[model samples]
Target: MWCWLYFYIFLVISQILYFSSLFFLFKVMDVFIEFQILCFNSVNVEMAVFLDWVSLMFSSFVFLISSMIILYSKSYMVKDKNLDRFVYIMVLFVLSMMVVIMSSNLVFVLLGWDGLGLVSYILVIYYQNIKSYNAGMLTALSNRVGDSALLVGIALMMGLGGWGYSSYMGDFFLDMNLIMFSVLIVLASFTKSAQIPFSSWLPAAMAAPTPVSALVHSSTLVTAGVYLLFRFSNLLSRESFMVFMYLSLFTMFMAGLAANFEFDLKKVIALSTLSQLGMMMVIFFLGSEDLAFFHLLMHALFKALLFMCAGVIIHSVGGCQDIRYMGGLVQAFPISSACFGVSSLALCGLPFLSGFYSKDLVVEVFSMSGMGLFIYLMFFFSVGLTVSYSMRLLIYVFIGQFNVLSLINLNEKDSSLMLKSMMFLLVLVIFKGSILGWMSFSTPYFIVLPFSMKLMTLLMILFGSLFGLDVLFSGVGQSSSMFGFIHFSLFVSGMWNLPVLSTSSLNSFTLNLGKLYLKNMEFGWAEFYGSKGGFNLISMILYEGLSVIRNHLKIYLLLMWGFLVFIVLLAIV
Candidate 1:
């Protein structure tokens, strides 16, 4: 059965590769085709496919990363009894992302959008535990907000008599309807991308199997929002752009800060994904859609690779995900360690790697833009935070002493297929930067900046590395000043108590409201006046009638006997 599943995965990979290559050619030829699938005459319902470089290239990258994830999952989930079901659900998830990527109509986009939310909920709760259930609920409910926003946007578009991408274009800034629609689109994107207040779900979503995390954080689930924004970039008003721009910047800063304090391996990676997503949104709003999309693709490559490596390490460590319990793994798992290190470097935007090309461009572009001093320094500082946490990850997992129990088994040899999948992405993480950069940008961006401005990025990286080392050293029983530091760590690591705010705080209020409703409606006045009151009244009336009959029983019987005798005599006469 496992062999057959492997064969199936390889077959799917080959087919996806063939189509992706074909799509690449289509992209190169600058071809655009719209194929109408169905049209309704009376209500004017229509379904059509929009083929272009944007959709095709995005689809190709999504498919490529999904293929690797599936390959990795074949071995990663081989021991599971529901492996077949897992594979099927994963494929369905990928197909839904394809629909979102290729559809130009808002209605179909919503359809695909809802599909992603539904299937992701399934994947998140696949373990059928309380944690998974909670995570699934958070993931679904957060995306549901986006779904509603899209529904409202579609309804708003109905006034204009079209649901196509072009319908959202004209008179966007002046017309109230168009501006409202644009706001709805931005709101939908925010929820789906897990931006700002919606961000608690991203780390909570780590309850899912690692493969799902890789696919989700990289290409399908979270990217759906950014892609939606990319499609509607031209329609966004300056006010909306500026508002979200600052929010996205804060998201980057917050996630980077949180990752340094986090101990869970998967969640740290999840936070990194959020940080990168914020960066994408920031660059997108800065008037470089191409750079945003470019970064998205590059991010997908290395992030997927990063998650896969994390998965391997987690699997080898007897399901341990805490980096504190994981140390000195490099000697036990050489290949996985190397892949993880390279992916981390790529994530830190090491020069010439896949991430550097896009990240450097983002920094250069942000520097070139006429922005305020605070945003500028905060942006670079956030970049430094990224390096700090990544270095912390390396130090904890590789350079530190072995911290796990001696009896725990650790093996890397059996995960041949998993390693192979990692190798595939490792190659991409190394070389895909230049390839994608050239393909994405027809002409390079020439930004002339002062030396100090250009050197700031490197300086931040160095400072961040030193900070990471400081974090390691400071962790050694430094009890003199831990009181305030502990409180601060709790705030940042807990995403400023967002999980509690989004879940527990709101939940407590809602549950209290429900209890009050139950008391008032069912146990209070409603019960007293409705069925319970009626039953009591009927019982009281019956009790009174029975008492009166018992009191007058003797007299009533005598009267009845006398009347019977009189009636008998009259009949005889």
Candidate 2:
């Protein structure tokens, strides 16, 4: 009882602090406008760092979303035994995210960047189960690889006469080395954003608790990589720009494809999040940084709401997460079903929702970049895939027949008011973009026509939905064989064709060359030291060679000893 009381008290305090900080952040923004402060003077003599429009916008989002997650978590995590530990780690996570957004120096930025990753890892493994622990470890390891690349990129910038964050911005475009640094930075961003190969860990990360999923995966942490890319957009090279665009497009397509096959609820969301981040990456690479930033904000709102809704469903159903196992839930849990539907439409980028505005803005940016027909067509295909998977999730979870009624056992209670605080997030997902409009940032692309591209896109979505439903419900596309022989042959050929050097071959060549010269030198040290068989074999050769030399040197040693004795005798005399 005391534990519960303490938990509630801490939650109340956290909520107050969160809301107050958001209020303070807004006040700071208002003051900045009133004072007409364009830039700040450098505080450090060694490194010049400036506060700017981009940093300010990111900082505002980080603070606001972090606060909202905290409030949402308080209710979401109400009954967990480790509520105190959860809150503590969560607060640190928010603090680190804020620091990442606000820090001007690369060192400080990295400090926050790494700190957030660490806290998130701890939170993910908070359940202390084997699966969750492994997932957390994988997440940390991948992020560390990204962090190392980022650090190297920063070091390269510093070596090129770039002092810190300030030198990477305006007027610094003349530096040639910025191109190399930007390439490395993009590599780092790809890993952190979970593009292609690095993306496998994200769906695995669904082993974590739902709040961690809602907070880290959905809203803030995943966006950090894309934010970094946009932050240093001016320094990006043409090669790196193409690399970013192509990789992001490929990842988006692949994630959508994978999500269509996924049955796990959180994994579906994880893949969908990956796809959305890829879109943002493409937008940023195409010189639509502001639009990407805006989209990122909108993505956070709906994604978090969706994840939270998933959390509620999982909790109510006693931890059944497979979508195929869920159905007829619309009649059983009206509120959750409604929230899920709204969030699904938002994820599908339906008009008037937050996602629709941001997603359309991204498409418009891509269309204007003169990238040609191929790129645009690829993006259009990705959009169709996105709709397919998202609708698959909606239909399977809420609208279909309840296939696993025994698993859920309807007597289980609905979530409490604390859990339901997530409804506010749903509300925001529905109206935030329309209510605020695009003026505060830039006006969103408003494309108008009769049989317009937007209408065509909607038609594609409808087609995708029908196709996905047919595949899921009617078994239209089901296959018993996981891979055909031709596909397996191609996969093997692809792996064999990868350009990595064969380490075993190189090692064998070197060993054979050494053995020719040292054949007679092998003997004895293995026996003397009682070493492992392999080590003993090598040691014996070294010992035999040294022993032979020592034996030969004994004659010289005797001569020197005799001369020393004569010299000592003469001195004594």
Candidate number with greatest TM-score:
1
TM-score of each: 0.88, 0.75
Q: For model 1, how does the per-residue alpha-carbon lDDT over 138-172 read when each residue is reduced to its tens digit?
A: 99998998999999988776655467765446644
Q: State the weakest 10-residue window (summed lDDT) of model 2.
A: 493-502
Could you tell me the lDDT of residue 521 within candidate 2? 39
Q: Give the Å error, residue 171, model 1.
A: 6.0
Q: How large is the C-alpha RMSD of every model relative to the true structure? A: 4.8, 8.9
Candidate 2 residue-wise lDDT, 1-573, digit = tens = 433444455445445544543454445432221122223353222322344555555555455455556665666677787777776787677677766665555666777789977987887788889989877887787788788977887666564444355544664567676677777778777777887557756776788778778877654678888877776676677666876688889888777766777678998898889889989988888877877887887888788878878887887777889887888777766777788788788878888998887787677657657677887788877888788887888888878888765744452154655345567777878887675344434444555445566465777688778656655664423353232332243232222222122223435778886776455334344334444566778888999988878887886788899999999999999
Give me the runs in candidate 2 sitting further than 4 Å from their true place.
1-57, 160-163, 168-172, 407-414, 442-454, 476-573
- Estimate candidate 2's RMSD in Å: 8.9
Report the C-alpha displacement of residue 273, candidate 1, in angstroms. Answer: 0.5
